[model samples]
Target: MSETKDTFFDFKLFKRLFKFIKPYKLVFFSLIICVVLLAGLSAAIPKLTEFAIDDSMTNKNPKDFVFYVTLMFAALILQTIFQLLFMYYASWLGQNLVKDVRINLFDHLLSFKMKYYDNSSVGVLITRAVTDMERIADIFGQGLFMIFRDLLTMTVVFGVMLYTNVKLSLIVLIMLPVLLYATRIFQKYMKKAFEEVRTEVSNLNSFVQERITGMKILQLFTRETIEHKNFKTINERHKKGWLKTVWYNSFFFPIAELSASITVGLVAWYGGLNVVLSDTVSQGVLVSFIMFIPMLFSPLRQIADKFNTLQMGMVAATRVFKVLDTTSHIDDSGNQIATSLKGDINFNKVHFSYVEDEEVLKGISFNVNAGETIAIVGATGAGKSTIINLLNRFYEIKGGDILVDGTNINQYTLASLRNQIAVVLQDVFLFADTILNNITLNHPEISEETVVEAAKAIGVHEFISSLPNGYHYNVKERGVMLSSGQRQLISFLRAYVTNPSILVLDEATSSVDSYSEQLIQNATDKITKGRTSIVIAHRLATVKKADKIIVMDAGEIVEQGTHDELLKKENGYYKNLYEVQFLQEKVA
Candidate 1:
């Protein structure tokens, strides 16, 4: 969110963008050839006009007139061909370059730690990858090379004008300093205006995405009017930023046009005076000087507008590069692969914190043997879920080590390590796709038959098949078409299909109806029978069947024992928690 440097042009940013053109070097060089051809051909037509007037028309020869006209026609045809080639190849290169950058950015995002996502906005990232990427394409397709073409045309036009008549060319040159000064002023302010516009665009996207996603909560709390006002404020800011650019454009272009028109009038006056009095300037030279002046000034005018396009692209590139430069990704340097990993897990005096000074889990130690089921019970902030996060290496531990199969977890490759554990969380998320695809996540190796069999093993196949299209039914975004309990069932089926060595279910049954809870409990029992499982739940009855229970309080284990063994302790933490939950259940 930091603003890029305030400058007319950024050399480093341009060099970074230019690197994307390397793969298509042949096409790029071909484009340069087209640009040169177009500029040269366009400048020739005006000179041809002078030839037809001075030679063919002056001699009163019909055959010579026809010959020069045909030559002019051929030049026009060649100009058209090169112009077509220039536009096509420029667009093709722009699209391919943007495609590569978008892919690289997406891959970088996937490697980032969860902590980064926790602190960033989904909408801001979407704008960078989607909207801003299109602006970068404009830099190549319409902005950069088009400016080059115009400048080359102007150069040829000015040189030819000077060669033909020095006095008249000086008349055109007198206006150059004033127009160039105006263009410089316009370019500077437009860069700042465009930077502001890009910032406002990102803010608008983030605000709208957040509001729409949370519309249900807004309506439930009756915050519609207040939110509308907030949206108006942001929308107004976005509009004003654009208007400033428009204001600058409105003020600058007329000055350029007026300057060009006055130059033409002055040249005509000077040439007419010489023709009638001294016979110094010929009528053909006067006509061509008139044509040449506009050709010279037109590109100067367009350069200002195209330069704005280039500036906007640079601003976008700066932002995108900032994201690509982030170094917060997890280290995947561990050479160990977790192939055929045993289910044993050990957390030896592990410590962690999301914030620097506020520890969430302090000196936590525990062990689960292969094929053992353990339960963790605690209050909301007692670090129950923190333990699960660490086990999956979603975060790095501050101290001590977590071992899987007697080797430090950090030594195992992340992909290989995570492939061996499956998690089912309380709030499940499903994509807007068929239920079968949602379960398999479009994995090439996971087939529909495997998903169906997994659903049957968890005893949800009958429920799924009863719906329209059975497993192929679309669940819509975030599984909105299904109930909370049904989504939880899908999460379980998803995990079961993986057949992981370690299973972690965090509050998996806390928010379901009694019937759904019973169904989930049965599925849980069947899946955890032989797998090493760790269950965390607020409902004491759910964990009563665990092989061993570890009771946590204030980031430390207060008791470790089986169900009856913990209950036998005199006024113990587990005994108090169980008794309270039992009384609440009886009252309900």
Candidate 2:
């Protein structure tokens, strides 16, 4: 999955984003009205100044001068008030739009399948959610408002100037083309620079996040110096990207300033000649024309600056859309829903692979009768967990069919299928929340009594009770605050809380100490009672209690029988595994 290279000004993306603003149209229209009013006031300022110079100052009319001055002040005050309203409404609308966009994005992301997350990076997705969304908000709030005000002011001022003096306006207008050309060129370069900057910033954030999350591993290996060097490299790359953006901005502003100066100088020279030739046009009108030239160019310069911001915003939008545009490889096609399930599982000629032409499970067949426990033992990467993943429909099988209760698993709604199956993985994960919350994660409606009962059934309630806040104790990110045993216990309780018809325990007790292992073994015995279960374990003792044991090797099931039956196969994989563990027991 490659990041999108599409530009930010993509019409389709803007059209999609504009939908978020539609709900707040009334506020948006009010903002536009304020902007137009402010622009009209801005253009009127120079005219008022011109009137004061011609009639009040030249003719020496004190009462008229005072009156016009008061009117000018009143307009200034009105512009300020309208400007405040414009800012308030624009901010309100932008924030509301951002909230709406984020909610929609999050809802869509949650509906995506596991395959989507498998191909995407956590850091990149997080950047889109936080940083990219913020940039879009800033553009909608500040950039859009400025664009509207500057455009309206530019148009009105130019019209007035052309009407008052056409020749001078023509000269000033010539500079407009130059300004537009310069802005166009700058916009192209700035787009690439901003994209690079955003990429580098994402890289820096990824590095920092990984380092902090893996601080213990770095310290254990004494790799602080190497980590420091790696961070420095990322930091330097970000700095270089920033420097490039600054360089382009440096060139952009100077060109804009020079263009403004030339336009003003041209207007002054042409208007001055007109005044010298005849007294038809007042000195006030000439002064006003000069003022109008900068007024016109100032907005042009602003548009130039806004062009840069708009490009940056486009870059951010491109990133955000990339996440939103990703197509999930796995999708639920069936509409079947079941209120309950009888766990009769069958894997008929199952063939599977993570990638094409690389078979992980080949021609595998298995069956588990309702209310039975089966153990699948295999060497590392021998497809033990792959079998469990397929059973849960986490990854679709490339060939063959898996059925539950004589119906193909794919024929069932994904939610209904998953709700009936619970998995306790080898590497247990717990959210940074209360113990009660973690256990009740799948069933928030379950009462505290149910949570406590589930935790007690898993032998975790006693430990949780010893905590400072009991079940309400915060776990810290990824349950880092808890012991490995405690985390495993919580995972067990979570699966148990679901009361799933079919339970899959993949190395569920591997990481815990012997004391916790005994507790887990007892808990498993209780939980697996009368429930169809698949147990994947490395420890021979754990599978010894299973009703049936299947051994796998090289993507094929090599042997299948009860524990005693497999132990009797003198040369089989299961026999060898039993011998190794039995010998280790003797040595201990």
Candidate 3:
């Protein structure tokens, strides 16, 4: 987010990206060869014109003029052919590179702990993977090729001009310093403008994504007008940023053009004077000098423009690398795999904090035997969710070891540890896919029969069967097409499909109707019958069936007992919570 002009061309990031192109080395080399050939043919065209003027025009030889004209046309044709090949290869390479980078980035993102998603915006992350990667691809495909072509053409033209007419070449060379200085200034403004553009774009993307996703909340609050006005303000800022970039580019092109023209003009004046005064240089040579001067500056202008593009691309690349540079707070440290988990979970005097020096869970310890169903109840922010998060290894405990099956959880690969756990959250999220796919996310290799069995076990198969497409019904984004209870049912089915040793249901039925809640309770009871289950619920009824109830308040466990024992407590948190929910149910 900072606009500081740090070095955007990160060599490490380039090295990683370059590895993706290694498989297409031959195509890459061929493209470079084509670019060189195109540059050579382009540089030779002006020389051909010079030959036509000096040899054919001066001598009035129609045959020679026609032959040279034909040769020039042939050169143009070859140039076009090679240019096409170069472009095709460049485009292919760029697109493949983008694809590879995106795939790798996506995989890397998945490997990160859930905490990364908690701290970052989905919209900005999506933009980095799609838009920013495309911008970098454009640089690799077009910008780098242009830089090479222009450099080659400029070098060849200048060398040829110097050899043919040293004095005039020297006069034209004077413009180089001025061009370089102007470009230096242009790059400064251009880099700043480009950084601003990327910032504005990221902000706009975030705003749009938030607005769309929170449309329901906006309607509930009747704040659509306020949201629209905010969006308009963001739009105006983006427009202003874009216009500033455009104006800077507008000034840049003309400065480059005027400098090129001035260089050509100086050459024409000095060359004509030398010829008129001493007759030392022939008319043909003077004419060639005039033509070559413009040819040389044309590539110069291209180089300037390419440099501007490169700067912009570097800005995008920096943003992308920032994401890649973030270190995952939770990472797998062990290569060991637990062949089997007995689900004996132990929290040994654990301490944790989202921020330094502020512990959320302090010196807490608990243990649960295999196949035991434990319920965690607490006031809001009483660290109930945080405890479950630790059990899932979503956040590493700052101080103490969490052991599974009498072995430290960190002693096993994260995948190995997580593979044994299944979670069903209150706010269930389903991908845009068939109902069957959502339930079968964990076990895509499972047969359709198995999918139906799992759905039926969760009491969702009947509802799905009633739909026109049954299990094949498409779940729109975030399962928007399904009701909340239906989403919860599908989520439970998904967890069941995984067949995990440890089950976590975090308020899994809190948002559902009574009927759906009963369905979920039945399904959860069946699924957790022989698994180590941790259920966090706001609705006390859901946890009454739990084997052991642990009450938490302000990050510490206040009480632990069976349902009957907790009910007998005079003023315990669980008893109070149960009374409140019971009164609410009676009122309903």
Top candidate on lDDT is: 1
Looking at model 2, the pairs that clash are: 8-314
Q: Report the lDDT tens digits of candidate 2 across residue range 1-588.
A: 122444435666678788888888888788888888988999898999899989999999988899889989999999989988888787788778888878878877887766677776677777888888888887777776787789899999989887877777788878789888887787778777888889998888777877888899999999999999988898999999999978988987888889889888876777777778876667898899878877888888887677667666667876777777766645678888844688999999999988789999998998899999999987888999999888877787889989899999988888899989999987888888888888788475788898888777767778889998998998988999988987888888888888999999999988888888888888898999999999997655668888889889978999999999987886878889777764575466
TM-score, candidate number 3: 0.93
Candidate 1 residue-wise lDDT, 329-379, digit = tens: 887788999976669999999899998978888999999998899999988
Please say which candidate is ahead in TM-score: 1 or 3: 1
**Model 2: how far is 319 from its true place, Å?**
2.1
Clashes of each: 0, 1, 0
Candidate 1 at 27: error in angstroms? 1.1
**Candidate 3: residue pairs that collide:** none
Candidate 3 Cα outliers beyond 4 Å, as residue runs: 1-17, 269-279, 583-588
Error of 1 at 564 (Å): 1.3
lDDT (Cα, tens digit) per residue for candidate 3, span 1-588: 334555434465567667888988998888888877887887788778878877899899989999889999999999989988888788789888878878878888887778788788888888898888888787777677777888887788788888888888888878877877876777677778777888888889988998899999999999999998999999999999889878877887787788778887887788778778987676777777777766677777777677667766667777877777777857688788966687898989999988779888888888899999999888888888898788778888899889999988888888888878989998999999998888887465777899888877777788889987998899889999989988998898888887889999998988998888988888887998988999997665667778898888888888898889998999888789777775577466
Rank by TM-score, highest first. Answer: 1, 2, 3
Worst 10 residues of 3 by lDDT: 1-10
**Candidate 1 — number of clashing residue pairs?**
0
Query: What is candidate 1's CA lDDT for residue 542?
Result: 65
Q: RMSD of each candidate?
A: 1.5, 2.4, 2.5
Q: TM-scores for all candidates?
A: 0.97, 0.94, 0.93
